[model samples]
Target: MDDTDQIVLSVDGLQVLIDVLTADGYRVIGPTVREKAIVYDDVASVADLPRGWTDEQDGGRYRLVRRDDSALFGFAVGASSWKQFLHRPVVKLWRARRSKNSWQVVPEVPPVERLAFIGVRACELEAIKLQDQVLLEGEHPDSHYQARRDNVFVVAVNCAVAGGTCFCVSMSTGPKAESGYDLALTEISDGEEGTVFVAEAGSGRGRSLLAKLPHRPASAADRQSAKAVSERTAASMGREMRSDDLHELLHRNLDHPHWDAVAQRCLTCGNCTMVCPTCFCTTVEDASDLTGKEASRTRRWDSCFTIDFSYLHGGSVRTSGGARYRQWLTHKLATWFDQFGTSGCVGCGRCITWCPVGIDITAEVEAIRDSEAD
Candidate 1:
């Protein structure tokens, strides 16, 4: 967060930084063009990144576009979030095997994934913090999340380009990373001077890594240029959400007509919950071999939109699409505050851009507000 340790790195130096992290036994995870979309995957070098590409995103739409400038972190968030790596979509809990007519239960060995997350956005960082609160700070902590989170290196990116659905500024989360990063970089494209990055060390590990990379001390001009990038991104935010009094607003609007309207367009495909970085709901599945000698239990991500998600002995609590949609929205904007002292929505807009029917959360909330005001 401090500028005292700020340094400058050329595009080549950025590659060196990646090599250093990889040499230090970290799986270098970053953004790359895959299937025509910039997605997070294993990066072998700097060339693997989507350098000259950005994305055009809106409700029910996402398309990759080439940028005039070859900026690596120019695009907004993709459909894939950090959740797929940290809170795995599916995990085997334990396996039961029959041995000598007695079942032997054996726990699955935890994976040793020392990940180095590169190009992490500010809202993504905040979402990670929120997950930490739920998965680590809670009474019954998730061992899988705890194990995967240990010793993970975070390299955050200061946004220079805002996507069409980005509302992190309105949510008070991004365009700039304030905390939760080992190293933060702001990529500045200079016409003749070429592209350079203003890097700052946010942790001791970051400071150590920066020391190894080839870089010069950032001048006052460098710092100002970096600050300008954040300013530009903040002003370019594509959407705005009224974060004030959302808990009480949604709390009182439980029976509002907006839910039914949204439900009409909702497919309940669970795309939003899957892309949500903070959604932690999951369900377990038990499997057995044909011989019935071996059995296993696996945990996979689940969504509130599914009727079975609220299944009880007699029937599912939320049978209608309206009820399920209300549960998803209200819990995100209302009960999340009661449960965890913070809004569940990070305003990253993944839910908006990836929805099959283009159901926008901000618009849905605004509809209720407008109706109540009328």
Candidate 2:
């Protein structure tokens, strides 16, 4: 963002922003300490933020650590993303009642929820955009996802520190918030500065809302400091994967032996897909009460790792664990561009951290590339 439009917010001002957003009738959700992880949930005030807390993440590992400074939003992403709130793991479509040997369909009419999400990362923002392409923009768009996606407010945060599993820099997705946000915050803390957030407005609504907060025009020095934050983070990314012609690379390696290697390590537990920010596969489930008087339809998230996900008339496709693993990684880094005009991955690296066996997506692709060279 240009220095002319930049501004600064103190800790108290940050709390005011949250209060103002709530007063504007938005359910302000943000990162907080939950279950020893920084998860997104209802954040009523700045006090609810995970100050002085950061996370240590690696393949098949995650631990919460304390930072010397009380910098809110200092940590990287946890297991949860904003997808759960927007895409929703479970949705009730409708209910029905049987009256006089006839069934009457009952329509679900729930009040639309207006949500304001804070601490959304740049790659996570891209994940949301990818979901919009799949669920909101196509000819046969998903009405349920669209309904929840509308009228939402986004407050993006630029990374001041990189996670042990992060590779967003390799994907060219972020260390900074480029777009798809209302307000973007960069927390700059030092002994001289104590702690203050440099805020940038990305939309008209953001600018209007920012003008109401207790803030001062950000100086050029502050802008430089904020730029330094992303630079340091980008330089220190924990992992990387080459993206040039990646689609073709995976496509040609269908019979690659490395698939079997990964399959041996993969438990087909679907943990990666479950924690993924952009995986949108879902299955519809219908159930009836024992009384046979009421019935309901619901949509729940499904994964390619499940055997039943590819069930056909007689049997399941991709029967072997290798085939299932290949399908997932291939679709994420290769065929997703064919389907959505963008890579299915934003390189957040949750797949590696949350995998029980520490399956790294970058290493898998590199192995395929190395095999091609050999």
Candidate 3:
């Protein structure tokens, strides 16, 4: 990653740069205000972005309210997640046909498109990394995942505003990105100074794009201002969690009463897993055609919160909703490091922000810790 103080575009110049990228054969997907929420969609022009739009959210609560400024990427994530693009909520796996003597099966591998994801938050980037480890690093990498991930370009944005539920600072995934992006942007603005984007190239591909743009070398003051902004955003987080000794904390607290306490409020709707950037568990299903002459297989995202997620020969290993919820929370906050060498959470706070029952993971952890301290 190269943070060489490059001033690639003024805030207004970003629109022109997007057009150039589109002409250069990149499918640009970015945030646009729709139905009162910032959503990722195909953007042909700068006007497509949610200018003068923003959002307000709390646990089990969301509203598409207005902001004082017309900042496009001023809000955090919404109900939609990056998983919708990568894993796909629903897809056909293969079509099968039966002959007189035998059944013939043809496996399907869906084609992927070249995409340039713009304004990706740091937590979403971390979730992509986690999926890469699960989908690409295994003995058999998914061909579809490989195609999409390998071909896509990333343009990460440092958060200028933290959502009411955001806690990326606690997860150490933001407000300034450290890795996993092709290009990074920090928006700079003031009533008198106007707006500019402090740009940096994170890869060779990013440098090539930077070279084509009309830009100047950034000053030391520019870098300092960017840092200051990121720092402020990080400090303003609505929640915090103690991650040190998390594994031990969860491991020792398996029988803690906090699990049952959380279960009372947890609806187990799996919204947390669905909104999570890194939860990659999925299930495959096979179904026969009406005529029984053909069959199809499908794969869709699944969550441990579901009762069937832990089904065994006899029955579900985790019989209680409380147990299932505890398993997921523990795996993400505690045991994920042992298995993957990284915490499962990137602190996007989607789990907490979107949960129908307003179950907060940070609060849950703190409760467990407080009990242990007592």
Candidate 4:
């Protein structure tokens, strides 16, 4: 909130910000149009952004359409999150080889890359914070995650247009970014002056970067414009998750008939977990050469929806689709609070948009609550 942290950047000034980050040796990953979707990818300049494009999203549907004007950060949350960079899908844990008489082992070292993430939404920022808690501050901290997370910088974008599947307002995580970002940007256009970015520095590094960019001190009007945009986005959210006693509701409804109802429609495709920004389950695989002379262990992303994910000595624990679906919802909304002191869901609504059958979590939670009310 410092006066020095507030600034207004022209639409063209975005390229300067990217240049500064790149000059600082940070690999800038930002939103770009690819395969008809806005995805996070390597960005070099403003030209790489999805200009004049916004996305339409609903249950089990997503499409990019032309916007009324050229707004770089016009789209909502996409399938990919910053998690893909920090918590990699596949990582080699260690490699071992047979020695003359014994065995030699070599631990996998973490990669070295300085990453600067751009266009991170408020909900996505919360998801990253949750991952930090699980992978960095947990009892058994993951060194690989820590290494990648430590060197990364965040550039958060406040939502100006809420997608049809968005529910971050109800989750109290977004529409406007609060913290965890080095720099925060809010794009505002009155149609008369094209587009301008209202930027604020959240960290010392962010302040330094802002100093390097071609920016002017934000006016009182500029601040109000940004606030109005956030308010509009919050008011326009497509869904809402009632969190009052939500944990208890899920816990007591373990046997709720709604579980069976959703299970019948659920495909167990694991798309929800894959698209989720915060789901962090992983499994390890061990492989060796034909002669057994070399062996390597690699860790990869896994999903609770998978039957093999619950495999035990005899067979999978949660064999039924109903059981797996219940476990996922319960863990995500109920027990996760006990473990992480917060709900696992950020209400970004990726699971809803990406689900092939359009299974909506907010709707499911409401059905359970309504049933209890009955």
| Tens-digit lDDT track of model 3 for 116-197 | 8888888788889988887888789877677778778888888888888888887888878778998888877643446677
Kindly provide the TM-score of model 4 when superposed on the true structure, using C-alpha atoms. Answer: 0.98
Residue-pair clashes per prediction, in order, are 0, 0, 1, 0
Which segments of model 1 are wrong by more than 4 Å? none
lDDT tens string, model 2, 79-139? Answer: 9999999998998888999999789998665448889999999999999999999998889
Misplaced by over 4 Å in model 2 are: 99-102, 191-193
Better of 1 and 2 by TM-score: 1
lDDT of each: 0.92, 0.92, 0.81, 0.91
Candidate 1 lDDT, tens digit per residue, 273-357?
Answer: 9999889999999999999999999999999989899999989999988999999989888999999999998889999999998
In candidate 4, what are the lDDT values of residues 216-278, reduced to their tens digit? 898898888988989999999988998868899998989888988999999999999999998
Candidate 4, position 338, lDDT:
91
- Ranking 3 against 4 by TM-score, winner: 4
lDDT of 1: 0.92
- TM-score, candidate 3, is 0.95
Per-prediction TM-score: 0.98, 0.97, 0.95, 0.98
Output the better candidate (1/3) by TM-score. 1
- Give me the runs in candidate 4 sitting further than 4 Å from their true place: 190-192
